[model samples]
Target: MSDPVRCMTVCRVCGKEDWLDVLSFGPMPLANNYLAPAPSYDDEPRFPMDVIVCRSCWLMAIRQVVSPDVLYRHYVYISSDSRQILNHMRDVANLAVTRFHLPAGSLVIEVGSNIGTQLEVFRSMGMRTLGVDPARNLADLANARGVETLAEYFGEGLAGTILEQYGHPRLILGRHVFAHIDDLTDVINAATRLLDPAGIFAVEVPYLLNLIEGNQFDTIYHEHLSYFSVGTLRRLFERHGLRVVDVARFAVHGGSIVVFVGQAESQWPTGKAVFELEELEVRSGLTNEVAYQRFAERSGRTMRELGALVRGLVSQGKRVAGYGAPAKGNTLLNACGITARELQYASDTTEFKQGKVLPGTHVPVVSPAYAHDHPPDYFLLLPWNYAKEIIGREKSLLEQGIRFIVPIPEPLVVSNESLKDAAFSLSHG
Candidate 1:
């Protein structure tokens, strides 16, 4: 099928190779298109969800334009759910306070602030806090929850609006939001205008090293316009008059880099980790085509084996279903070509997506109750991050000796006993 939406997807950080065909989730609808009714029989337009790579910069990206208006207009993510994430936000806030010397009453603004879970902590510390998010529903929710928010897309234009309404923020934070884009210049300009002279702009994104070494292709979706690394990110930020001062590798989001940047005009230590990571990125082969070639080759082998396993179970008439309709599940379905015939339905705890189908595979999403009443002979846990959580939550279902498979990072099965013991069930799927 021909692609619909027209989007120019040049590498934002560097003028690398114009294109590299990464993967194609054929004719997929929006990843977050969680509608109750099945997409009507009426023909619906399909935009290209095909992914690409920048051979020169070693950047992997998606080619699509669902427009932030349609994608992030009703943000559903909440930050406080994961204890690790909650603590990370508070720790970063403290770091900004001490390191940047963000004075009390000075502003701290977060672009793409979903649910204001992070900003609430900043507000408690006497910092004037503002949240910019396109999600209208979440903006109203944040306002009701006492975290003042502006319901609009953030860019240089929005930055001007903020400067006119509220004083420039002393600390600007964009977490995973940094990589969710095809156009980043507007955001860089926005940061320049909205930040005070010495203010720091901190971004936490999944390290490209993690994406490569960990085989995190599921992190590849339409929403994530470009996957970033210290090398690409530093180049992108510095080109916009911002400097990457320090970076810390954290265990969040598979593996991540928490980057600290300040005005190119400001004087900071330019920590050793800065150059070390850049060198490591080069040595790690992030900028070379070889790394991507290797990832794609290994992925081919991985998918064939797992696909055979699932197909075997299905052919045996063993009823199979899945848990956690995850983002990565999109890639898995496309790569392995697991269509709706293999699994009956997939279940997720998020109400916003309860009745929707997986974007590319058209796999129906059911509520968790399906596990208790009509459990499938086998259960597949799609979100490996919350595998333990799913195992714990559905221990009773697993007690029936239903085999649970964990796809990716090398597929493995969950033993019934181990699944029961891990009752935390705190899945971020």
Candidate 2:
């Protein structure tokens, strides 16, 4: 049998034993582990989702660490699925090439490059690109698309192999992947070894400040081992002989911060963005325990509010189905104890999730075409981060008097009138 999931004893960044309990969602199923219709809940796996913070480095992370093999080997999240993400990646690629002045044929490597979408952008820009991802299916697709990808977990050993075969990379970028890593130091060391002396390592992770401020408790799951802030990232990179040279914030993935790191001895200029964000982190109470306590309380309130809202709608004989079956959606559903009784089914575009039921709630996932054929009274916006884009996409349904329930930060129902006003504000503002 597989070993039980283990609790973290020391901080991954500072190796300190000091820890502060932040929040607990009791036991939750693996957020991305969509099950077949046949699997019984009695046999389904669940683990503790206790979030904690390191008092020494102020790094927030989950106490239990699930094995990466079970979490990522057969992943279903496709980066190319979202149009907004594609545009964001295009922007990221263009900025990296132009801002860094990456000449043609410069080797660029991406860790956890899902389906090689972003790396393909780099390849199109005349740069040599390599992608390292653990998902064999995605790696195969990436290779078929001409973006040479390796289906291997990256660490010190694989870093040596890549260095020998592909030479040192001019840029090593990981988008939303660093937070999933359990061994931050090992990954940082591997990155440091695989990079050229003058190269830069850019990592984009969900900003901790954004999580607390936006009350994005749904983003917490077992796969995401760590939550980062500019301050914690600075400490993490510095311990591995790398320095944060630059930082930028983006609204994608709720909110994320891309930190640019370089070898400490390198002459890369530290941008004002780094210092400015670090100060902001301190002023926002990210470096203290009180903020976490408040966040925990707020998360509980959100769960209760969302539960009451959905239950109320069900009592009125309203048919509510979830829109978008993202991993975070599973966390929210399980945490709030919402099941198939509340949400009939979750509609998604991803074929991999269409026939499978949600991790714990047993809410069957359906295709968007099927959902449209059998429309519900309200669509519980599961991926609330893209509320505007999703609401705009279903304009016809909105015009037909179908409302949407957005459950995050608070539970709010969106109607045609509200959407029009929002669109007008966006256009005029």
Per residue, candidate 2 scores C-alpha lDDT tens digits across 29-67 of 999999999846798999989999999999999999998
C-alpha lDDT of residue 364 in model 1: 84
lDDT of each: 0.75, 0.89
- TM per prediction: 0.88, 0.97
RMSD of each predicted structure: 3.6, 1.8
The backbone clash count of each candidate, in order, is 2, 0
Model 1 RMSD in angstroms: 3.6
Worst 10 residues of 2 by lDDT: 420-429
Q: Give residue 14's error in model 1 in angstroms.
A: 2.3
In model 2, the Cα lDDT at residue 29 comes to 96
